[model samples]
Target: MTDTLLTEPDAGNASEALHEDRLWRDNGWTARVKKNEDDDGWAVEMIKDGEAEPALVGPWTMGRDKKNPKPLDTGAFNTLVKTASEVLRRHEQQLHAQLHKRMAVESGDATIEVTLDIVPDEDDPYALLTAFDSFGEQLAQVKVAPNFKLSRASAASWVENEFRRPG
Candidate 1:
């Protein structure tokens, strides 16, 4: 076979290994060195526990024979776990940025900070439009359509209309 696996179960599923030449389970992550389908080289995939897809995948090193992948040890597994966790963290940050927005709107004598946080509920997706004063006191909050476009002109109009729920 082009690939070799050594395993049992994972922490999320069980307390063991699963597949690949060198499979390791620790800290809610599993690193598996698998066969690279594109070339004759080897690749490693880092999968987080309970996730359907791998968090990171990259090329792996060859052994002394230059044929098989280097066996994964404690050090390598720890590094993979750190890298995978960072990847997940960055992904979460990006998603948060996409779903939430904040901006400052000059309303009369005070500057109002407006924020739009989107809730992507499969059944009832919506957005919360909230306004905070310069002193960080919440002024008003309204539920709006998830597809509401949060822009400078729109925010100004909303503030001008006394923070009415967007139509």
Candidate 2:
């Protein structure tokens, strides 16, 4: 739905995104070939737009003379973009796993699932501690510090305390 809000590419920047022998820019990604610092070989780096660092970098094949790096072709550029996009996706998934957690705590009458979802806000980072029953009904929810670590022991303690806000 939000795709409709995206603005068309600027004609003025068309020249900047054009492909070169050792550089290519498209699909919000830039692939640049440079000399590898470790050896006399070459390397290609793929950077996503608006990112300060390259998402992926690896060795590049040499030309016929075995001196310079091969030109960045459309096929190679597409492969680099795919690999870099996967890297970014995996990183995001790892971050999400680290920020969100869930545990089942046994109570007197039944089992309750407790979840902690962290909000890494720049100014006021926080987390939502929520409890749910087997039927998926939200029992309670409270805001807590972002650094709050959720564990089985803590979840049981929170349940014992009547789902109160934790420190």
Candidate 3:
């Protein structure tokens, strides 16, 4: 006996339907359309699998037709999901790389100076990047983890905690 695996066709119509409905579904992300509570525009919610809530949420613009979206389907949803996820992933990687580069730990004679690079993390709006020194001291910290960011807050906090001027 031979095992046969079933595969679904990549249909444009299906994708169109989802796109019309303002829903995008990808590998592990789903972008849904919702009305903005404070304004008349629409909002997008990116939900990831296994997450209790949306991974990201932001405003969305109307389509070329300048009309509200239709019901979302598998195809259209998938494409949007893929695009949004890729954008977010790239942004996160950029932030991580930039943070590592900008937050340098330099020691001169007896004192160490700290710097902070801040950038926005669209996916994790509330989270920040922080770097520490060998003595568990913070060098820099940033609230937003964008393509280029540092954790100056963490560094300052660490310094304050570890090194206090004599009164």
lDDT of candidates 1 onward, in order: 0.84, 0.84, 0.52
Q: Estimate each model's TM-score.
A: 0.87, 0.83, 0.36
In candidate 3, stretches whose alpha carbon ends up further than 4 angstroms from where it belongs are 1-26, 52-68, 102-167
Write down the lDDT that model 2 would get. 0.84
- For model 3, residues 1-167, the per-residue Cα lDDT tens digits are 11121122234333332233555545555567777778877676776655557656777676666665344567556656676678778878986765444333344433445543443456653334455565767655444434332345544444555533212
lDDT of 1 by residue, 32-89 (tens): 8878999999898888877778999999999999998898877888888889889999
Alpha-carbon RMSD to native, per candidate: 3.2, 7.1, 12.0
lDDT of model 1, residue 84: 88
For residues 12-62, what per-residue lDDT tens digits would candidate 2 score against the true structure? Answer: 563466577776778788777888899999888887777778899999999
Using TM-score as the measure, which candidate wins?
A: 1
Question: Cα lDDT for residue 70, model 3?
Answer: 41
TM-score of 3: 0.36
Candidate 3 C-alpha error for residue 116, in Å: 15
lDDT of 1: 0.84
